[model samples]
Target: MKRVLGIGLSLVLTLGLLSGCGGTKAPAGDSNAGGNAAAVFKIGATGPLTGGAAIYGNAAKQGAQIAVDEINAQGGIQFELKYEDDEHDAEKAVNAYNNLKDWGMQISLGSVTSTPAVATSAETFKDRIFALTPSASAPAVLEGKDNVYQMCFADPNQGSASAQYIVDKKLGTKIAIIYKNDDVYSKGIYNTFVSKAKELNLAIVSTTTFTEDSQTDFSVQLADAKKKGADLIFLPMYYTPASLIFQQAKSMSYSPKYFGVDGMDGILTLENFDVSLAEGVMLLTPFNADATDERTVNFVKKYKDLYKETPNQFAADGYDCVYAYKKALEAAGCTPDMSAADICEKLVKVFPTISFDGLTGEKMTWAATGEVSKSPKGMVIKKGAYVGMD
Candidate 1:
């Protein structure tokens, strides 16, 4: 729903050096001799295949697989996918990046979530590896790196968009918040939301916190919000904790209009959780699988047929990220065995001024800052699925 409106800033990045990323490139005269159709364009991916963030990570992995299959079928250049499980842990992600580099991976499509992406991008920044993450939105991931690109908007932008959505919709003036205090992504969005809300003259009725390792019981927080007479509640945590909050809130009979961000996107897929609990829940996200556009309908049908489940925002972004790279490669006439520097140069030079009609159902463009310039859409859950807020 959020099509990039106009031509974005040019993408001109200067990757420091690439001596450490694979060996030197082939001589100019030997372009197709040591590169191109025969050599494998190794792409490494890392995500949480078995942990709390597995929902987000696994969705991205599946989407990436779909893109890989389609790309290989067309047979432009040889490509290989090497996967590693980071478990959503920063240290584990670092290990995964190291393993991929050891295995001669030239490009990366991971680490799926923000925390891991931030950790892994540190080394990639030093090594100048070209990485385009599907779902990592924390600001830390792209602070100093020229090679790291993101498909999703950063937390600050998402938070501002959430505030704008609430204000524009006239949802409520009195807002209550219960956020994960220990998590990077949660804290980033919460701070920006609060700041924007204050600017818009919205009242903060209640503010509560919970750490990842803390108790799951949110009765106390709900009771506090109820006592404060808050009409709307914002829960900026992942679907796992948000589900627990909803269940406990329902038990306490504390019903308030619920607002969430992309972190709560996987709520419908929670194991054994009743789908009705998500009814009327509003969120701001990158993609909505139930959209009616030709691209969206085709993607949703194909994704469900392949994975036997609906695709999430992360899935859409993952699919888009691969196609973005493919477009850049095609523009630069890149071969499979180009040096990391050469590949990085091609991406930087080719991405600007080029727009992609991506699987996210948008005509998206890249910013010079390594982020996409597409707008965020507001969506609401109804009848056990997400639909446009319009």
Candidate 2:
């Protein structure tokens, strides 16, 4: 049983300019309109429905769906969900966008990771549509744009929180930071973690970068860390590689305590992973399945009943992201003139000072820098259970 805290307000983002396209105001649930009969709004997602990153993408999809369901149930503004699979590729995301174009979708919830998010951001800006990513962590997504927004915290905040977790706990003196070189998401997280580690006075034993698609054989990195006598390792890679590295490290009888950024998830897929191997591994993430607040508990129950599986962190963020938009749309009075682009602009102006009662509890008001100011909680995988670490 996990304890729940207050809800938090998430990140604020400015999107790109909207093209002056003719807008349509179709009646709710018109199949001719390419939306559900009961839906007042239709949102699309371009995510990896299949492929290695599907776990993360699927979680995002589920989260968006949860929001749609909740909003429609209350009979406020009926919302519909549309999902497009990009298979975690940039080119495919464009193809997905073209598909949604025929469906007349203007507000999208997609592009889980940075690659697709970046690609879609350019295209959505060109189309003047509003694309909100709940999981994209790269800062470049928000650089001088007005149509894209991310609900999840960026790597800078997550990295700072992770570093603080180690420092606050006095977990280790020396740490190894492992990251992928070319990937924007991994690189962004690595940069933030490095900067924060220095501020926290944690000695960086090694700064190693790996090719995004290539394997980072732990042998070389571990040998280097062993040489430096490091006490902890911060592997800032996504789940696929992180799991492999963990297994490889265990094979070498190397068991330094581990910490990671939000890119790490799906621990159940790790190889040769027993309870002991994952004992002390921790991550700085917004998704906590163990929340205990009334809304959170209700959300978990409703989600499990609908999806027949437990909800992940990305899903939670997605649910919150849609609701945040819904709140702003409501404030804007969801009129025929109220386009997603208008809501996006309203989001930038509204988020800075608004408190949201989210599924996670009470989220703090949005920060002026476009990030959430709420304090983050830590979770450790102890004995196969994710427990909130104090």
Candidate 3:
């Protein structure tokens, strides 16, 4: 009888031990396999969530979140996303990358801006983590980085495309360019635009530059363009400086036809910005929220309903980035239980072969060099809204 009791007690103790072992949670960065919780791929991104460039960052985060929510609801493949604020700083971006790495980020949305993307791209390459940037359009962001890709048009492409569109439409006779000399994004676009303009025999009347310190005062640059009889001004910088330039130009009553690149997208939403100053502003961008396509209409409606504002090109690019990732991951048959390196390898192999159609572009394909091929659309700001220039 005593021996029977001992055997029963031992069996109960063994059962309790097994139960405790089963209840032990999986370590951080490991996919939880127990229960009905679906395994989710972890995606990490870093952008300027609280600085001057917060508009771009927040737009990207929200857009990507919407994609994630939709995908999660579908119950096919799920994703967990986390975005860190880099404040548009390169050093801070590197720190953010490290943080994401520690959190077991299986994939990365590199950065919203070029400088930070450039900084983080190196770390991703070193760590064998795949990255797809929504709006970091610099060539250097993809240079020597096979696992990194871009969703937005590269600076060179934007510059060359802008020049071609302007020439094709006969938008201006004499073009003047004002670019930030210190910025990689601005300088890259400026160089390509000048090359393309010259190739097309377009007359360039004035070319001026500004550094970060002198961006607020564009009076000298505008005066030079006006003096040179420039009928149109091309701005390859961001919206902040562009907004100031518009104000300064309006103050002097020098209203030439203003043309901009993707960097000028958020000007319409700029706080305290007078929409009248941008009455006829033209920009070469990939996404037009006012597009009548069903996908665009739905995305715009959802964005407005959730954020209470219109979605911009950056937001569209971010949305496209996630969908592109989804397509590639689905094509590659990647599982959430895979290691980050394995996911990176699968994505790097699969991205070149898949064609993605998203809010920003249709039939978008990535080159081996990680540059995305997509046509840009011309948008004109009319009555405080972006109208497709067609």
What digit string (tens of lDDT, one per residue) describes model 3 on residues 1-390? 999999999999999987655223323322222322126678899999998999999999888887877776665777778899999999999999999888778899999999999999999999999999999999999999899999999999998999999999999999999999889999999999999999999999999999988877888999999999999999998899999989999899898999999989989898999999999999998999988989999999999999999999899988888888888999999987788899899998999999889988889999989999988999999999999999
Residue-level lDDT of model 2, residues 69-171, one tens digit each, is: 6666674576667888999899998899789867767577758888888888787777767666888878876666666767777777777777888899888
Candidate 1's C-alpha lDDT? 0.81
What tens digits encode model 1's per-residue C-alpha lDDT throughout 107-174? 78868888898999888878777888998988888888878888888888888888888999999878
Residue 275 lDDT (model 1)? 84
TM, every model: 0.88, 0.85, 0.92
CA shift of 148, model 3, Å? 0.5
| lDDT for residue 295 in candidate 3, whole number 0-100 | 93
Candidate 1 has a TM-score of: 0.88
lDDT winner between candidates 2 and 3: 3
Per candidate, the number of residue pairs that clash is 0, 20, 0
Candidate numbers, best TM-score first, in rank order: 3, 1, 2
Clashes of 3: 0
Error of 2 at 226 (Å): 2.3
Cα distance off (Å), candidate 2, residue 84: 0.8
What overall lDDT goes with each candidate model? 0.81, 0.72, 0.89
Which sections of candidate 3 miss by over 4 Å? 1-38
Q: Using alpha carbons, what is the TM-score of model 3? A: 0.92
